[model samples]
Target chain A: MSFNPFYILPELILTAGGILVLLAGLSTRKWEAPGKIKPYSPEALALLTLTGALASSLALLWRPEVVKGVSQFGDMIAVDPMAVFFKIVVLACSIFVVFLAADYFQGIRVHRGEFYALLIFATLAASFLSAATDLIMIYLSLEFLSITSYVLVGWLKQDPRSNEASVKYFLYGAVAAAVMVYGMSIFYGLAATTDIAAIHSKLVSYPPDGSPTHIIFLGLLMMMVGFGFKISMAPFHQWAPDTYEGAPTPVTAFLSVASKAAGFAVVLRVLVSVFTPGVVDWTPMIVALSGLTMTVGNLTALPQCNIKRMLAYSSIAQAGYLLLGVAALRLSPLALPAVMLYLFIYLFMNMGAFAVVTMVSARLNSDDIREYSGLAKRSPASAVAMAIFMLSLAGIPPAAGFVGKFYLFAAALQSGDKTLLYLAILAIANTVISVYYYMNVVRYMYFAKPKSDTPLKPSFAMNMVVGFAAAATIIMLISPEPFIQMAKHSAALLTGTP
Target chain B: MIPLEWYLGLSAALFCIGIFAVLSRRNAIGILMGIELMLNAANINLVALARYMHPHILTGQVFAIFIMTVAAAEAAVGLAIVISVYRNAEHINIDKITTMKW
Candidate 1:
């Protein structure tokens, strides 16, 4: 019940920063003036705001109370290692996205200030989402994130494709949200409390004979529809490919990495905290979902010619693999860490790949995979970086994706559950199927004939993002111990032991 | 005083109608209205449950308030995007908004 200001410093900074950036964008002064006494460029200001938030989040990681976990604001928010970990992930992705947007939107006439402000606001929502401990907080923050994303997705108002993408995303998002609220209402009626811990305690106290297991299960299933849509799980993933293909590249990157990561963070929290095994066993359902999501995502990804669309399916498949870790949570201690570790690796590789896409599409004005023919000849640095990202995404050796997938699969196998064992094997088979499409990008980069001999020079910011991501992908493979230990430490949730 | 089960039944019916409208409607605004209906149904459930089950605390009523505020915001953004789409594609029919497909 403590209302400590320190617990929410990062959110406060982001809220103030978003408003400041928006106001700064209203000024008519030359933002790009060299040697100016006071530089007020939206990009610089946005980066500074993100850096401030990132530093505070890092500082929160070392707080004495965080190790044991503490609830603030009447138990609405939980500041724990897991929440801090996801905050760092969201902020890191946002910082990289600012860099990508700076380069992508160069010389464009769009409202740059509003774009950065919305990004900061979206990050704010995600941060709140990861830490929310009440149904009301969760619903509010999740919808906040969705509303900001709908606006961000349609930022390029002149592009018909962007307009269509935003509309489709809004429709699906609104429906999913409404259904989720309905489910939350059911929980409210059952427990008469909005706090997750309270709900769990009340459910546990109910007698076995009189407990409303069927009603609880129904509510749980309905809520899953909302969470499933966020992570782009199968059967609820209809909007992702179309949105990814049509939205601006930087926004696409944010959706794939940051938004999905936030979704998983909240999902893990709710599944572990509120739905204990004594109440209901959710493992079987998650297991079935893991298998179906991967099979559908990988199989559909094979035929996509658009790189963004292909990557959309690839991310969906990655979500499936992440779900395998979730399905094994009760049986094995390794499950939570494995999921976190994979998401950390995914942030780098996915953002790096999208950075390259942003740069190439900015220059070539095309998203078609065929247009990337002989990129090795046109831009050797970018082509090589793209190849590394593609390799990492495919879970090939000497790349971080391999280490991540190995841990995820290992977690499932260590669970000793017959179903999880079969799921690991199915996941391995799906990985094999995934390689063809991942390598197809490589084939176009190096093996295919050149469209022209002119070299494509990526801007400094784009190059830095690509190089940094590529280097991290390879370096994590070489030394994964530190990252693994970090994940293990951050696996601690508010109420449960991992 | 009304019984709690009656209120639950009424809300359930409203929820089903909302879902049906969302699935079957072709107009974008029609779909948005369906979503609003669905949210309102949840609001009714929360308010009714609060009155019947937890009379001491205002948790459910407060929750209903928050949901109403968010639903309004959602409808605003949804309509803005719909208008943007209409300006670009010259129509707001969900079926005709398909410039992208796998």
Candidate 2:
């Protein structure tokens, strides 16, 4: 099997860039100027690397072979339109995070280069995860992502909360990865192959009456534990709130949006490719999980005073809504596209919310909701942007999230499955339950009295990220046709069972 | 010759013991050990299944090797984190590390 170098250009770029950033961190010279708003070398290099990778990913989207789906690396990974789209999303997320971190670590005396390098590596892992077509590739890339995240979460070694957060994340992540690998071992035993396509073919070759249905179900359930932990699904979400609250806010944003997207990408790929409808009817299981996940996330989010913790729960609920798209995959043609669209929109809104949180927390050194009182007076631009993000997250009309949710729920309804229909209704109730907490931040920003009248001036980099995210969010709602078409175009995953 | 069922049973028991230790142990290092036990159980399963079921291919054996490598790396990182946590909290007790509510 000859390895094709052209197919993995983005990964190569990220690898080179991560190494370069890590090496750059060893320089002793000061790069920051006293008065000018210039980015240091690590930030500049990371941005350049991400931009290059993003361009390559976008180029892959237009390749005729890639659009049709091309298996690379001896069928360990697939460079399909879906993979390219997710690669783009993940790269864009890293780019925005670099900007967020620039202003975030401005005053802190820490190793900025290592942080950027790890972020790049995490992005690399996420990109690999989204495209992995073999069980080994899946396990390797998922663990790669988790280990990098553990380090990033615990980056502030001196802070006890950061240390605690990293420990919790590592403990949960290691156990989950082990369990997932065990499940993959079972699949290997059953199929005698690691390639997803071969596994699917082997599973389908079993005689129906003598099929090892119970064992297959056990493997599937075990694998979901790892995937569920990544996406913060119910019963596996205990680590999220503490981790989000304790970690630096920029890392929190990256984990919520980028990591969760990668998790969903792999989940959808595995379910659609390896466990096709003829092999295993997983729709019922997905429906139950989707309903339970949203309810748990929304109910837990109600009493959170900490802003980051609240967003953490809200992101979990968002994961549940995303799962609706997966549940409807076999029944509705719109399901995959709906998931793509929601994740794309979520990238903007969630990051925008966190960017604001990062800025506010940097100034006040507080993530408590009460600290946001009269934010409209202190920083009208940020307050308004926060309001836009909050409204969008709550799925209000005229915001991008409403359109995204509309497509997801519409996909579920279009499935014509009764259980999915009930799940969709339950999701709607979860949405209603979620609006109160999301708006609680807004009410404080607009109506509550200010603790201090001093204006909170956001730095230029943060301003750019927040402004770009806000504009993208509103514009996506206004002209959602192109985005929808992009999502539809990118939904052509390579299924093996067909 | 030992049957495949015997190997499968042994691996399952090991995995269950790992889970029990992970849930019951309060020491962070003990939990880490449990995780290692679970990983090794899977390793045993993979290698045994590969030998008995698919002797013609090295897929399961190769996967087991990769799992072992990754497991080692995981342990190193996990121990580093445990050390850092201990430095801050002055103890490695999982129950007492609850600055944030579980």
Most accurate candidate by DockQ: 1
lDDT of 2: 0.91
Docking outcome class, model 1: high
Candidate 1: misplaced stretches above 4 Å?
A28-38, A493-498
Q: Going through the candidates in order, what is the number of backbone clashes in each? A: 0, 0
Please identify model 2 stretches exceeding 4 Å from their true place.
A28-40, A493-497
lDDT by residue for model 2 over A1-498, one digit each (tens)?
Answer: 567778899999999999998887676234442222345478888899999999999988777878888888899998998889889889999988887887777666678788999999999999999999999999999999999999999999989999989999999998888899889999999999999889999998999888898899999999999999999988888899999989988999999999999999999899988888668889999998998888989999999999999999999899999998989999998999999999999999999999999999989998999999999999999999999999999999868999999999999999899999999999999999999999999999999999899999998778888999999999999999999999988885543227
Q: Candidate 2, fnat value?
A: 0.77
Docking class of 2: medium
Q: What share of the true interface contacts does each candidate keep?
A: 0.95, 0.77
Give lDDT tens digits, candidate 1, residues A1-498: 768888789999999999999988777343442121135777778888999999999998888887778888889988989999999999999999998888777655688788999999999999998898899999999999999999999998989999998988898998998889899999999998999888999888888888899999989988888888888988789899999989889999999988898899889988998889878889999999999999999999999999999999999999999999999988898999999999999999999999999988988998989989999999999999999999999999968999999999999999999999999999999999999999999999999997887889897767888999999999899999999998988885533552
Reference-based lDDT, residue B79, model 1: 86
